[model samples]
Target: MRSPAAANPAPHLHLAELNSFPPPRSCLPFLVRRAETALRRRAHCHSSSRRSTQNQLHSLQIPGRISHGNPPPPPTRRVILLLLLVVVLGAMGNSIYKFLCGVCSDLSDAAFQPHGAHASVAALGRDILEFQRTKQVPEGLSRHVVSSPAAQANWYKKLQVAWKKARPAPTTPEEAGRLVVLTLKNHQKADVDGLLAFYGLPHPNEAGSAPPPAAGHHAPPAQHSAPAHKPQGVKFELHTLPVDAKAVADGDTVTVYVDTNDAPSEIKKAAAERTKARAARNYPTADALQKTIAAAGYRMVPNAKGVEVLAKKYRIRLSGIDAPESAMPYGKEATEALLKLVEGKCLTVHVYNTDRYGRSVGDLHVGGVFVQEQMLKKGFAWHYTAYDKRPELAKWQSQAQAARKGLWAASKPQEPWEYRKAKRNGNA
Candidate 1:
């Protein structure tokens, strides 16, 4: 009983001690220790809260599941990266599709375009000339050739045959003109006048006096009147041996080669100089005219090749003279005058040079008569001073002008060059 009471008394005494008004000053130490312990407990709680916050922050930075909340569906970074990759791949695929479509459109345009007929003939002529010079097929002509090697070979062989069949170099202007006509006639029919114009040759109608007096019409008797007095210094030497007239081109051009011992003589030069002096006098005296008429009996026709003394296959341009084009005023008259001089006659041709048209530029003589001088005297053509610098031709032109001959009869006559220019401008 004493022990139980004492134990109970000890509990009661401890309670009584706690309930006392104030603890001793010595107990302050224990209170301080308890306060320190409570502060330590608060610090520990604060540290744990800080650690939890740090853990939450670290989870947000990781872009994956959050530790506190429901784990984020998937990492935001991974989804964003996957979307970016898909976008990049899509852009790359779109660029490659556009480049392939452009190439196919260009090949279709080159395969078809029409080539002209007249153009083909011109091209052929150019090719022929080029081949003669270079011995190579022209690039322009090659387009007409077949693509296959065998076909091309056959085409070339045919071309060679055609070349051999064609006539040789033309000996006269008339012959040259006819050669062009015949060539076109054989290959394809074309307007003769138009073809002549195209080839830069004077039209046939403009090349001589008249269109050969039609087919069957007979020519009128020759008018043999001449200047009255003989030119004092002029000496006439007749070639007794006759040479064949190979060709006659225009009013004043012819092609003839000597078949006999009578070669081209220096007499022609002397005669030319004397003629120049005579032309300078403008009008011949009446006495001289009478003498010239008497001497006209000396006119003699020579053996010739072409029909009516006109070349069938040669090309020659009249030297020192230009006849009016058929399109020009008085052009027909000029041509008619030329025909009257040379048609049905043998001529002596003196080749001077070659023209751009591949025509022989030369002086023609009919029965020892200077054809160009006759043409000028008759007012059938201009002296073509640009090409012929002899003052004699100028004087002849002046005389014709004074006499109002041929084209000079017009109050204002247009030059052939001017007429051609007007035509080109579409102003005619």
Candidate 2:
């Protein structure tokens, strides 16, 4: 048998080759094979020795491979410290990556963060929304605007009721203005008092506690000059009539039929024409004004010009004649003239008994001038036969004809009645 050393000749040869090997001259493969053989043999020997040692350890009951019954002891302090250092380094790297990601994001979108908005902005937004809600109102709503809407609405309603109670009806703008001015002039402690003043209400103090007029300091007249210069049989009162004839009465407010059958057709037509003319002159169209009028709930009636009414409950007959009772060809022009004369201004009306047509016959005055007479003088309207029987009719007519005013401006001046007949016959 060969000696043990000869059997392990491959190992010696491998060592010799490693010690004397030249740097690759195509001999790497041969050297590698020799090294591999030596390594296998060494592995075989180690495995066999380990098996024998394991058998010996098992017989002596000395623990070797780790198991649940016989596990290895924990590392010493030095080894544990080294492992802890590795864990800490890994955590630091993860933290750095997170910080870099955050820094890379856009700063402009910082406010979009979860808690970006300030508390004050939220409060302001809530207040603005509330303010918007407070301003919204239904149509036909008139408020004093001195305070809250509810307060204003309540105050106006109370004043309106008091006015209706004190005065039976409303008439000329001057009369209404006087009522409003008087109320406004009255000093009261409450905002309601101011609102009442806006409606021209006389204060209770004025009626019950005011000092009597001394010497010549008399109260100013709201209408005609203390009845001295006023026409006879003419008066102003609160008139309430409903557009509908039938309704049950509840509380102080009652519904009555508005008698417009006897109203003059021409006056009604003139009112519509006037409305259109106002829109044509002041705006692109009448839609806006019409919306305003409708929103205000103003109504028209027969035999009335520029009459805004709360049915029979309240009817405001314009104090002056801007156009004829019937809408003649120049009705819009006449209406525009009247509006120009009295718009945004106060005027007075001396009302007579309701005419056969259920219209208030009145002498209208503006700034101490008789509006009807001025209209006639300006040749804007003819003295209607059924309504105007003043002695100056013939004289005014002759003057208007001579001046070529109003309808007389026509080349062959046709009378209003003649024009109507001709129009009806399709010959105008």
Could you say which candidate leads in lDDT? 1
The C-alpha local distance difference test score for the whole of candidate 2 amounts to: 0.43
Off by over 4 Å in 2: 1-227, 235-328, 421-428
Q: Name the candidate that leads on TM-score.
A: 1
lDDT of 1 by residue, 192-309 (tens): 3333322333223333322333344233221122222433322331211123233434444444333232312343333334345555773354335434422432111223222221
RMSD of 1: 26.5
The lDDT per prediction is 0.46, 0.43
Q: What's the C-alpha lDDT at position 402 in model 1?
A: 94
User: TM per model?
Assistant: 0.31, 0.29
CA displacement after TM-score superposition, residue 270 of candidate 1 (Å):
43
For every candidate structure, what is the RMSD over all alpha carbons to the true structure, in angstroms?
Answer: 26.5, 25.7
